[model samples]
Target: MTNSTPLLEINDLSLSFTSYAQGLRQISTQVLKNLSLKLHAGEVFTIVGSSGSGKSLLAETILDILPKNAHVTGSIKLDGAPATCAALRKMRGRELLYVPQGVTNLDPLMKVGHQVCLRPEQKQYQEAAFKRLELSDAVTKLYPFELSGGMARRTLVSTALLGTPRIVIADEPTPGMTLDQARETLQLFRDMADKGAGVIVITHDLTLALEISDTIGVFYDGTIIEQAQKSQFTGLGEQLKQPFTRALWCALPQNEFSTPKHTGAAGHATSSASTASQPESKRAEANSQVIAGNEPENAHDAAATQASEHTGGAGDATSSASPASQPESAPAKDAAQHAAQHASVLEAKNVSFCYPGSKHCVLENINLEVHEGEIVGLFGGSGHGKSTLARVLAGQLPIKQGSITFDGQALNPHSCSPVQLIFQHPELALNPRWRMKRTLQEAWDVPQSLLDKAGIRDEWKERYPFELSGGELQRFCVVRALAPTTKILLCDEISTMLDAITQAHIWHLLLDHAKEHSMGMLVISHSEALLNRICTRVISIDALNNHANCIEDQ
Candidate 1:
């Protein structure tokens, strides 16, 4: 447990996937770059990054679970001995455990009880673990589909601890759970670490995870850009060593977002004016009063009145930033004023939907409208139907109760779908077999400049989904959704998997394009700060559903 002998040590780990592109041409896509970390007993080591930053890949590599085509070059030592695949086999379940990000890990046809119990003798331990996680006896008899998302996550957590592993790697284990459920699930990991077990958790953000983590690793584009104590993420992120780490900390809903003055040599946010010309710079500095004064008398007219009355308090909170990061307050007001004159482009009137077998409806009698040149924020937590409503509006899901119209025409997924949708999980949205170039070409003949604007490299065009990182693949998806035919854009947590700098650039491109074409967008995200910064009006999905519970707490 001491520095002299750590429980797990990963040194200079680099991973690449060998694949055939186009014809029989061989290509290797390097994913991890010189990744190294040490996990000692009794510490909750948390890794936070944008999607596809190789956080999950690191966990998979440590567990020796990478696919056959994966070529890894690194030294992983378990208890100071070289950890090869054979060594991982000896340590996987007995000494080490893994909690996956998705709940589909459970076999659909298998009973929850059998899935948690690794062996016949482990049934008793599995039952005890379930009880500790607050799973009832009846849950054991049910299938995964019968369980809620929170319940399924708890089941996965219990499965990982069946053998009481000394080292645990939990990859993005808190998604789809309510705030309290996520906190409780992470607390269980913290408890495990407190009892002298080495625990690792990969997370999207540190808003809740920070409270339990002892140390934090900030990852950016396949590398650990910075490592710091949990307490170092304070004020304006001055204690943080890496610019990307500071940018991530600052971009949180709780922190003030200063425009990136420049990107550092490592691609981290610094004083980079490189992306300053992006439309996001203006949107990011837009009048906070646009959505901060609470829901207006009429959500559509809110931006108009607020822009008319917005004064000079926008820069006060972000005073700690450098002069270059600040934008003139006049441009934001002008942009909002111009947006106020646009006509309605999309509408969801008295719409409601529910999963086929669910007892309660996720959305009920929801009425909303998006005006031309407007960015409406659909703010809500998991289980509140933010995603479902997005799918329905985008015509991905059927409209059963009411209607969703774009440009006064019915939305049809099979057709041109003026309502283009960029999904929450880019991995599922993109085709695995298609190369990046082909994926982009499916919708529009996207230009290289457009791809570059989305932070994509030209070389990535030849690589398949498996060869690219999650964030990289997502960049392709974003560019595709911005097709010329798209009218009402449905951005379902589009930037969730991207780093702060890349996120800024993409938003800059989207907002800029939206302004030029007078396009309306429905932005669904859990980050209230982001919604506040970019949206003309932010409305709660739960409020739309007539649920009066805590929206942020889910």
Candidate 2:
């Protein structure tokens, strides 16, 4: 029973913001340029693209939530009639619903149950929504800050379920969820579309998009470059029209995992007709060689060789030096020997942690170690204390039992910590009032080289956190954590919000810098494929905690 006419339509929609330059001069930056799309009843349409490509902006525009300085020129139609901002506002809760990407969308002071239900009559619907999303009834009584990332995400989804709406817009809703949870969430949207609601999903995860979408729109440079049926994204993306679309498909972790060969004027992937026409086997072979050839022999050995070449075998030693501070002039053999004899850069010896009033211990007797120049992957299901362990290691949370140490010494809370954490939600971690430049430089004076590598532009420095997209803000967070004094990094799903190419680029730069400085990293993620590619060895949270059966199994 699909509708013949469109349920929602946008015609030649554009959006820009007015900002000030250096000397009281105003400039307009257009974020969405003539973007247009249609949503039909009983169809799930997905928009996939790199981060900062205006996907979220489209969602905001439809909801009539754009800021005061935003200039919008567009026509939004519902049921074949023009939909104004006032009309959108009036119909927002009853006829339109949204599942935002940021968990910060939840009001901080209000209880979760109150926010989800909103009215006394919605209590039953709220309970049902929470149960379907696997949230505990007790969660309703808690505040936003009291819940874990996955719990917070589920809470947001519950709000959308409390009403019957004609259109549902979900923006990047699956990052903090486990694979099964993410699949279930997407399936819920698919079911909604089956019930004659127009569903619009925005994400950078191609695998998930392919599974749930009826039509896929490739968004790039503030416009839809290509639109195709889900069936068209088959083996090698041969049927896809746009080169950037094919490039995005090939860049998945399970696929070629390679960047595009050519770029357009905006530095994005451009069409290479000749390359696209090549046989699939040849392309696969080339990609395999590229991946295999890039593996370093030994991270520390490479670091030692580079240091020796630069410093010419000079040795400098101090009494307080840690393992990562092995003399710059040390030869590869000596560097290896020193690493073998030294303690791990960060260690948790029989560590256990519990929340202030919770009866259950989230983490118990967790023995973990991250050595210098090692990338340790932590894999677990959602709400399994993976993030809690990262916070504990980074000293954001204190352990109730056992000991945590850095280079065989206790962490000093007074001074700046050598271990820094990069959170999954960059928006929550950053200051909304501060400009990007101030936020990036809050910890240290980051170098221009790092900014360039992270793709941070000078113009972006003038924007606040809300003005920039999630992926753009994440780049700043990554660069901020790479200060010279940092010895270890705790990355919790850091690349989940990025597109395939940007994800690969950031990882490449991060891996190189970690090897060069002999910095250890504890990478926490739910993607087994990603962990297999980047980690020295992946450890399960259940195994690390010595549990036979975990909460996820139940």
Query: What TM-score, to 2 decimals, does candidate 1 have?
Result: 0.79
What lDDT would each prediction earn against the true structure? 0.70, 0.76
- Report how far off residue 269 is in candidate 1 (Å): 9.8
Instruction: Identify the candidate with maximal TM-score.
Output: 2
Question: What digit string (tens of lDDT, one per residue) describes model 1 on residues 1-554?
Answer: 45568889889989998878567899887879999999998989999876566888888899988899999997999888998778889887788989986555789999888888858999888888877776777788878765655567788888776766799999877654545666877898998899889999988757777889988988876878787887898898898888767877775544544435564332323322222322333334342333343544444544444442222212222234322244447776676555454454688898877666555566778898876666777765554577778778877776558888876778665677777888766766878799877888888888766765565766778777766655677788888888878777888877755655566656666766675566778887756566755665567776688843221122
lDDT of candidate 2 at residue 530, scale 0 to 100: 63
In model 1, which runs have C-alpha deviations exceeding 4 angstroms?
A: 1-4, 20-29, 49-51, 102-158, 161-163, 176-178, 220-225, 256-342, 357-360, 412-414, 547-554
Listed in order, each prediction's TM-score against the native is 0.79, 0.85
Residues 1-554 of candidate 2: C-alpha lDDT, one tens digit per residue = 34477989999999998878889999998988898888999889999987788999999999889889999998989988888767888889888999999888999999888889889999999988888888878888888887778778888887778878889999888887887788888888998889889999998878988898999998998989899988888888999999888878877766655556554322333221111122232212222333333333353444443322221111111223322333433466466555544735688998888788766677888898777677777877677788888889988898889998998989898888888899988999998999988887787999887777677778789888988788888888999999987888899999888987777667666766776777778888877556655555456776677642232222
Q: Model 2, stretches more than 4 Å misplaced?
A: 1-3, 261-338, 546-554
* lDDT for residue 478 in candidate 1, whole number 0-100: 84
The CA root-mean-square deviation of candidate 2, after full C-alpha superposition on the true structure, stands at 8.0
